[model samples]
Target: MPEDARKRARRRLSIARGHLDSIVRMLDDPEVYCVDVLRQIKAVQGALSGAGDVVLRGHLEAHVATSAGRGDSVELVEEVMEALRYR
Candidate 1:
């Protein structure tokens, strides 16, 4: 993985962790605002989405591109297809 991508993933994960902790605390409080909880959930989802994007970008740039350059991208394409089948 690229250093920059790794850093971004780490940052996103950190934010996700904080969001999860807040959610846990909110669960203990009877008067927690629903909007605040929803906002935190959205923040966590966005962070996770960003991390997924980083992983996909790295896979495309390093694995898929290299496989294509070597004229043997079939396996990579097949793997992606199989993964997408469940979606």
Candidate 2:
């Protein structure tokens, strides 16, 4: 992965981790609003999605684009397709 994209994904993952911790704490608090907790969960999901995007872009740039000319793209393409299927 490129240094910049790796850094960006790391930052986003860190943010998502913090949000998940906060959500766990909130879950333990009896007075916390359910709607508010749901909102935080959504925020964490968005952060993770953004991080996934960075990873996907890095793979496309560093692996897939270069693999095509080498005639070894089948596995790489299948892996990307699997990821997209679940995403």
Candidate 3:
């Protein structure tokens, strides 16, 4: 992965972790609002998705773009397709 992208992904993951910890603490409050919790969960999901995008872009730039030259274009395409299916 490119150094800048790797750093960004790590930062996004850290934000997600902090949001998750906040949610856990919020759960201890008996009067916590459902919508507030949902919002925090969404924040965490967005952070994770951001990280995924960075990693996927890095993988494409570093590996997929070279598949044809490496004679594994078909295999690489199939692998990426399978991964994207669940994404």
Model 3 C-alpha lDDT per residue in residues 20-78, reported as the tens digit of each score: 99999999999999999999999999999999988888878888999989999999899
Q: Output the number of the TM-score-best candidate.
A: 3
Q: How does candidate 2 fare on TM-score?
A: 0.88
Give the least accurate 10-residue stretch of model 3, judged by summed lDDT.
78-87
For candidate 2, the lDDT comes to 0.93
* Candidate 2 runs further than 4 Å off: none
Put down candidate 1 lDDT per residue, 1-56, tens digits, no spaces: 67787888888888889998999899799999999999989988888887777766
Better candidate number, 2 or 3, judged by lDDT: 2
- lDDT tens digits, residue span 4-60, model 2: 899999999999999999999999999999999999999999999999999989888
- Model 2, position 75, has a per-residue lDDT of 90
State which candidate has the highest lDDT: 2
Going through the candidates in the order shown, the clash numbers are 0, 0, 0
Candidates in order, TM-scores: namely 0.84, 0.88, 0.89
lDDT at 81, model 2: 95
Each model's lDDT comes to 0.82, 0.93, 0.92
